[model samples]
Target: MISPSTSQVIPRAADSASTIKFRDLDRFFLGLLVLWASRAWFYPGDVETQIGVEAPFLFYFTLACQLLGFYGLFRLGPPRIGSALMSQPLLLALIGWGAVSMAWSSAPYNTFGMVRATLLMMMGCVYFRERLSLSDIVQTFAVVTGLVMVGSLIAAVFFNFGRGTGFHVGSWRGLFSHKNGLGEVSAFATLFFASYILAARRAQLWAALFLSVSTVCLIFSGSANALVTVGSGLALMGLAFVTSKLTPSKITNGLIFIVLAAIAIATTFTLVTVVANSLGRDMTFTGRTRIWEIYLRFAAQQPWTGWGWTTASTNEVMTNLVRTTLKLPYLRSPHSAYVGLAVELGYTGAALYVAWLGKTTVSALLGVARRNDKISILRASIAVGMAVFGFFEVSAGVLPCLWLAFLICTEPKKQVGPGKNARA
Candidate 1:
């Protein structure tokens, strides 16, 4: 385990969010990435008369912001490359393999664009880690999610936006176009905020309030996957809080983390099964099994290389194959991130993804056990979320949450001098 660098100040802070430079353009750009991934109200409806912005304009604008955000990162300082890459080797491998796979992508044109966007998003996450302390970062996220929750409440009550489609009708969509999207954000908020409150003794009222409201919104969203993921995350954080009060030695800490991790994993898996069974649902994971079968069939044709990174649900070839092969309505994703990556990136990519996620989660779990800090707990919470949420949604690929959380956790604390952090 790497020693907590005297230079690394912000990694253990669950609170102490002072005034962030809210006017910073790079920060705004990162915020845009979150808003974009959240499927917020800004990008709603058809191409023509789609709110006020045109599709091409929005596309170029987003691209330009990403490019400039990269520049801002360089302007800040060279990243701690050795520490960053060493901490998350599989992540770099995943990206490297993804770039290579574009060469043979069945949807070559589409794949290139998708891969580039993913690369940019990951870069943006690194930039965010450099620019803001974890406390400020989490606080900023809390603020944004709070706004989203408020918007959802208003839309559900005043407007006609709550009665959404699929799985459960009349589910709340909030600021997003769909209830599943709503569940994703709401549950995310609940997970992070609950972890934060657990780690930090102060701000109970606000954090608890936010957590409660987000949990309610998550339930109202009615996505079984989201509900299960959120429940798992909250339960893990609660357990972390309970264990934190004990004064354990380093060896004891490791043992505790291992025990807690095992318990959390087993409990979450069992609860998810129970939750699904209670809903009277089959093992299809809401029609995902058929899609998974189709992808597996296609995958068998090129088990090693896959059709390339662009050949998942959104790929034209995938859509065509699904349409031709299955009588059920077409599916855009295999719905499982692990399987989806395998379809696009093959077994090698899938292995890297799993390895990377494991490292990220384990490292944070260790940190939480050692420090007994809310910030560390929050980190582990997000890591668990990535695995849980990614199981049923193509979240790791399309949503900003997973990568953002990973990059932030793995990023080395910015050093202001030989033995001091920027915050210090």
Candidate 2:
């Protein structure tokens, strides 16, 4: 017995509900894609042996997923792919340089694979930035990483799939191949959940729960580097929040941030020293300085253009050289992102990377000044944290999770006008 207007309104309401359901489904699928790209789950084994080698089934399955993801991203039609690419000119330059290095690479095939992976990962970041709101991206990551943490706990408790070996013996690695991997993921989860709690008015209970779990995981993973990284990041975030309240001027805020950043760096160094001493480690950072010395010597051999992208760890000859030099049978990475980049692409590539980080830091600070949102503050903090973490870990080159997070944080904020979808 409804009137004509009411009948029409009923259908419109139903249609809106249907659209919402479809959007939720779409996001669910995207979350799965994200989990895959992040490598949140991998077979338990020696991480060193797994790198640069993949099972046949996994290789093809991943290839299919990437192809399908690329197709879907384009088909869904992001608003401004060109603009997104343009905004990350330095990233593009870095990728271009990586591709060019294949020409000189002793293992051109390996370099090609590494460059392709980097390009695809970058494209995935662009899609995330252009198609989804920052909040949506953060929420997806939070949920995915939360699940990972929970699964790790279950695996460790039920299946005895937690302990590490060979120097990291007795540490909890959980679902990751190494304790450091778990630590990195846990640190990221903590950051994501903390940011979510600060930004959201509702559903913060879940974020708080996840944050607590992640903090526990971080502690159990026993990665001093991850602990330091997260601590520095949180400190910077706190500073940003404080500065945002104190001033409206971008210049003043920038000055304040610079001062705070310096203090944070000094404090972090002190913490590192204290942690090292308590852990019975020397100033050499458990022989990392010695490794750096050897890496620098190799890098000096090709100061302008190194062996090739990813060759620092992938090429058999380079691996043998490092193993023989370090007198260790197994070695996975240079252990320093900056040194790895310098070894792979030489000083020019390292300079470009530093320049990009500087640019992103400035942009993040400006965003905090302009928006004063938790997301902006988190972005600024993460930019600073990653810059510091790169000194001790291979956070830049091949680590999918860290690199993806970096891309998301560095993306420029979009402007919304009246009559447009604000979140979009």
Candidate 3:
């Protein structure tokens, strides 16, 4: 027999009330919005081609996400007061340059569509910056990734939703539309979880669990590129770790330099030859080299302005080659983000994009160096993961949902420690 006060009714009630706070709801809905609108295997059509039956619905659904996201902002309060955004102008410059390229886009109509989507997504990123804290962003992202893992397991058991065919054979696709897409996201999530674990080193059971699931998905995805991206990210982190530990002693410095040089050479050589041989692939990278060759040759003709937002400078050779040789019904990029950007927007455009990524990465690393917060360290790892992923994939330019997550999470925060009031 417990008395009313002794049972702690008031505290329990307070805790219950806290669970349903506006901010909590805000985080859940915003995370769900990112998932709904981002690149997942949930039956949405590509920005260029409306493939599935639900393509039209998904397109409009994403637009609604924009409106809802704005309303959510209004519900909270006015936008934050600061020039924090102005401090980071490279992202804006990148998107703005993308808009300007429409004038020279080979596919003008498609260019407008793609740019319009990018603008909407850019707004989402801004909303992320204005509203959520860094903790809110990473926790929400981790939660969503956890849901994806559970959903993939269920889908795989009941139907063929997550299984790969053709070259992938018995591999898993998880909830992604393609094996590479699944692998890419899974690998990125691995970096995310790893960063979380490394930063806090406490209550990391959830992050470790997510990391294992993501690694499994990455392996089952059979996306060689995804595997390579994960490896590259690890190598980059290793390099950062070693560099962080270096000393100023002359003998130690000389030894470290020699070791680093040897490692770099071995990594480069093995990445080119040993990796390909082990994977049963050739130097041409399963015809990707040919596809890139064609696109590069065409891009050279219009090096300054190239083509458009979602296409190479000229699709004539690219289209014909895919149709005749590859037998793929639709035209695709050269399977590398850098090459795709160079072909679509020329070297100048690609440089801006790469520069924006580099700036974000450096900012995060600087924050980590300052020990600003665990989230800052997490963002640094994520940026490294994205840099590696960018070499083999394209998301920032094509997919809105996942790219929105990356842009939002990786938005630089100066010094907002692990407290509740931290900045995102």
TM-score of predicted model 3?
0.78
Ranking by lDDT: 2, 1, 3
lDDT of 1 by residue, 1-424 (tens): 1223422444444433443343255456656666555556545552222234445765766677457435644645546533343445577678778778878887777677766666666666665665555544566666667677877877876777555644446788877766767887887787777777766656668778778878878888878888778776666655655555565575576677679769767876687578878887655457677677888777777777877875786576567778677764435567788888888888888888888777777766677667665556777777777777887877654334533544453444546588666443
lDDT of candidate model 2 versus the reference: 0.69
Task: Report the number of the highest-lDDT candidate.
Answer: 2
RMSDs, each prediction?
A: 5.3, 6.0, 7.0
Poorly placed runs, candidate 2 (over 4 Å): 1-22, 41-44, 47-57, 76-80, 201-203, 248-250, 266-284, 396-399, 402-406, 414-423
- For each candidate, what is the lDDT? 0.66, 0.69, 0.63
Candidate 1 collision pairs: 199-374, 313-332
Query: Higher-lDDT candidate among 1 and 3?
Result: 1
Residue 260 lDDT in model 3?
71
lDDT of 2 at 75: 48
Each prediction's TM-score versus the true structure: 0.82, 0.84, 0.78
1-424 per-residue lDDT for model 2 (tens digits): 1122211222334456766675465567557655665554454456655544455766665565455337545745555555566677887788789899999998899889878766766666665555554555666766877888887766655665676766777777877777877887777777766756665535667778888888888898988877877877777776776677677686787678778768877887798689878988755365787777888887899998988888888878877888888897777778888899899999978888888877886677666654565556657666766765677777544334554554553375544666343233
- What is the RMSD of candidate 3? 7.0
Query: Ranking under TM-score, best-scoring first?
Result: 2, 1, 3
